[model samples]
Target: MINTHTNAQDLSSWQQKYPGVSEITTDYSEHYQISINKNNQLVITQDNYEESMIITDKGTGFSAVESIVFSDLFRIKSYEAYTLNNVNGRQKKTEVAHIADKKLDRQSVFDSDVKLKTFNFANLTTGSKKVLKYEMEFIDPFLLHRFMFATSAVNEKRTLKISYPETVKIDYKLFNIDKNNLEIQTETKKGITTITFQKQNPVVVKQDSEAAGIMYEAPHLHFWISEYQTKNQTHPVLGSIDKLYAYYHTFISKINQTENQELKNFTLDLIKDCKTNEEKVKTIFKWVQKNIKYVAFESGYEGFIPREAALVYERKFGDCKDMASIITEMAKYANVPNVNFTWIGTRELPYTYQQLPAPAIDNHMIATYINNNELIYLDATNATVPFGLPSSFIQGKEALIAQGNSYIISLVPEVKSNLNTIHDKIELSLIDKKIVGKGTFDANGLAAAQYRSIIGDNLLKRKDFAFALLEKGNNKFKLIDFKEIDFDNSEKPYSIDYNFELDNYLVNSGNETYLNLTLDKPYQNDSFEPTRSQTFDHEFLQKKSYQVVLEIPSGHSVTYLPESTTFSNDLLAYQFSYSQENSKVYLNYDVEVKQTLIKPKQFALWNESLKKLKENYLETIIIKQHEKN
Candidate 1:
């Protein structure tokens, strides 16, 4: 028998190729078969999966556990596991056990029908392999999930093959795969088109903190049955954006056909005092956001279709789709013209409807009010989000808005850095080798949302959260007192006035004293790895301004002060200035994050910028003792 494990020299080469990985999939395959069901719906008939994993490091035993995740759309049929041990250079099959089978814990996020099926190898030495085999039967398949050849570990050889009748027209697009570099082959057999995507030793990128989603970097294939043909007719499924919209409309066409008297009465009564259309609509939308709880309820067909508006109002809780329905109904009832249900993908999904035109392209639903050329997005799921501002996650995304039977695609406006801002004004004084300061931190837009999420509803723990937000000067920072203003109002900016003291923060060597005045150094420890192939994405654009005035101790002479430094690039901008006038020292620092993505080519520039910033952090204002106080 041929040896499947890598040799001693090849083992080190594999390790070098895939850093931070001790195991890899030597052989993995996904074989899919599709056909038309009784309802004439394009469905996946069978899905067969096989995987063989081997340990590259001898120090750690191969206890590889195979996890099979499935949802209500699919049913697990068979599962098998085996441990193949390399005893005396000969392969031997050991135990077989399916360890775990249970529903996934869906805490606070959603109630899901997804489940997990897992099997594991107890303990196999180096060069030993673990094999897993499983099959699934699709109940109703709408979107074909993308297949990623690149995983968390290296894939020595991974294959995905789908077989369907020639009548069904399927389309697939490759992402981030260099066909010229990989050994790609295509062969047609028995008059059916055979396309092969073969890559050799595909290594997944090492993970970094706050990196973009894998969909943006992984070598994957997005395949969907665009349409199918019967003997007499051809049906369009998702061949074009219009076709996808048509299909999506069918789900909500029958919803809210009959209005609930209770809902209408409540909405009319709630908006009785509101004279203007905008005011009435805002009041109704806020009522839904405040009363109805948002729980993502996902099952088979329930995941795609929205419940009736009356039913959702009766239950007082629904998923994104359901909340959108009630919001639309109530707004329309309250004389808000042109209120419609909208579909959009959040920032996490970085693809547009034109790119894929599949349900997989969008994961969320909201409500939109359109008049003439203006578009207002209403996401009731976000209870505290302001009326005019779209949620931070959905900003700058393509929205599919409903218009009768047809639809229009529009991009959500991105909030600028200045809108979501944090501005600080602080005054500091040195006393007994310690620093004492009083300041007020003001935040607006998404910047305020960040602090609100941390503060939560715990009144007792709010002070500790405030301290953490303003913490600086190592862990010795202390918060003496704090008071908040306008925190409960979503439409207004919030402020926190605080008194803080830092013990022994100043460095005193004999007569010379050193101090760095910059606090809240955002992204100081963050940098895209020099070798990282992926881009770094920030969730939102932000601007921070820090103005601190320090009083120099009496009888102390200013010996040195750090000069003004500034750096500006496409993605970020920074400015730092230090000045001394009389006995008062001032620092005016500002940072504006212009864009979300830092491309791979800009890694060196980004790293250099961070390096300079850190060096400036080391630069301190030096004070010489002219005379003892």
Candidate 2:
């Protein structure tokens, strides 16, 4: 008989060889069998198996507490877990003792039909292996199927199999499969077709670090029921973009458009004083942004259908769909003719309707008003966003607008870096061992809007917030006195005049003084990791400029000045200059982040730019005392 000690030792040796991996997936398989009964109702039975070995304590213990998520569309058949451990001279197997079932209502602020089934294995420890087996049935055929091979842990073996009757025609697509070594096999026997996908020793992918969506990083498959055949007829489900749009339009059409007299009068009153159409639209848009509180409600049909416009107006709070409905309806009542309902996806998704043609492509709804052939997307969910600008989350994304019986797809423009500017000017003099300065900080465009939002209602905490925003050098830097100008007026740029002092900022040796002139180094350590596999997303472009004028003391003279430097690339640009004239040292620094995305291939160039920026921050200005004659 084989000794169990030797088996454990072999397993331990394999784990030691790959020390970076905390857990290993020994086996993962998903089998889906589909059939249509005599009543023409589609039935899908799924069997799943997941086996993993705990190599280390890092990420292994969490696997013992297994949780399975299911919705109203699925029914659990069976679930079980077994723990295999080496005890004394033989392998011992112990089954899970307890199982828990609970409603997953707290997963989000919205109500949901999803539920969770959880079970904890017994005696989970390092060098132990756990196996989870479960089966479920799909209550609806339209739920489709999605499978992924890559996981957080390194998977040694994975398999996905789908068997269905020939009467049902299913279409499938593979995403990000070319980057991995996955095998596909298909076999047909006696009016039944079977497809299998397998992967061996797949590399672990970190989803959080990826720039693109999960669909772009992991090897996954999306299978949908395209059509089904009966004795002498065929029926079509959702197979094309038109079909998908038709299905979506059904939900939108269900929205009760009955005009409420109170809502219409309220909208009219809000925009009565506006002079132009533009002003009227802005008034209505701002009113919705200020009044409607966004609370998402995604439970079954509520997830797809929007509440009535009048109901939403009365509720004072609604989700994205309700907000969009109220805004669109209010715009009509306000006599804004060009406004339309729009659908879009956030930055987290990398899909286009033309490519995926599914409901998963878009997750948000808004209102768009066109003036002079230019579209202004309004999302009331973001209360802080300005009237004419699209929300930051939907920038550079495609928008689907409702147009009579048809729809128009247009791309939302990306805001440029120069539009979001932060300009600062400061004049200071060294006194004793501290540096005292007074400067004006000016913000424009989105920067100004963001500042106003941050400083809202918290006037008492403005000093602390300003200090956090503008403090430079070291922890000893203190905000002395400050005055905010034009901050309450959103039409003008937000400006703050602040007086500050920095202690222990200057190094003195006898009569010579050394000071590192680089203040407010924003991107000091913003380099991308070398092992990063995905592109980086910055979300928004930004431009910052700083000017500092340092007054020379009564008897001090400039001894050395570092050379001016400039760095520029497609992703970022920087310029630093320094000059001394008439008892004053002037420093000008400007940087522009050109794009919001940094591709993986540009990591090296980006790191090089950051390195130069860091080196420039280390340059020092030397001041020497003048000798008395």
lDDT of 2 at 601: 77
lDDT of 2 by residue, 333-355 (tens): 88788787788898777767776
Worst 10 residues of 2 by lDDT: 1-10
Give the clashing residue pairs of candidate 2, or none.
none
Steric overlap count per candidate: 0, 0
| Local distance difference test values of all predictions, in order | 0.79, 0.80
lDDT of 1 by residue, 1-629 (tens): 22456455565576676565567777776777777767776767544445454545553334467788888787788867777776665668877654887777778557778888877676665556677777887764456777777876667877777777777878877777756755555555665554556666777666666666677777787877777877667877775888889879989999888868999998899999998877887887888888898998777778889998888899999999998999889887787888899999987677888778888888899999886787878898887777877888898899999998889899998889999999988999999999999999999888787677667678999987888788877889999999998888877888999999999789899999988888668778887665677767777789999999999988888888899999888777889999989889999998888877776787888778777777767778898888644
TM-score of each: 0.90, 0.90
Q: Model 2, stretches more than 4 Å misplaced? A: 1-10, 20-22, 37-41, 56-62, 74-77, 84-93, 103-108, 125-127, 137-145, 207-213, 231-234, 448-463, 484-494
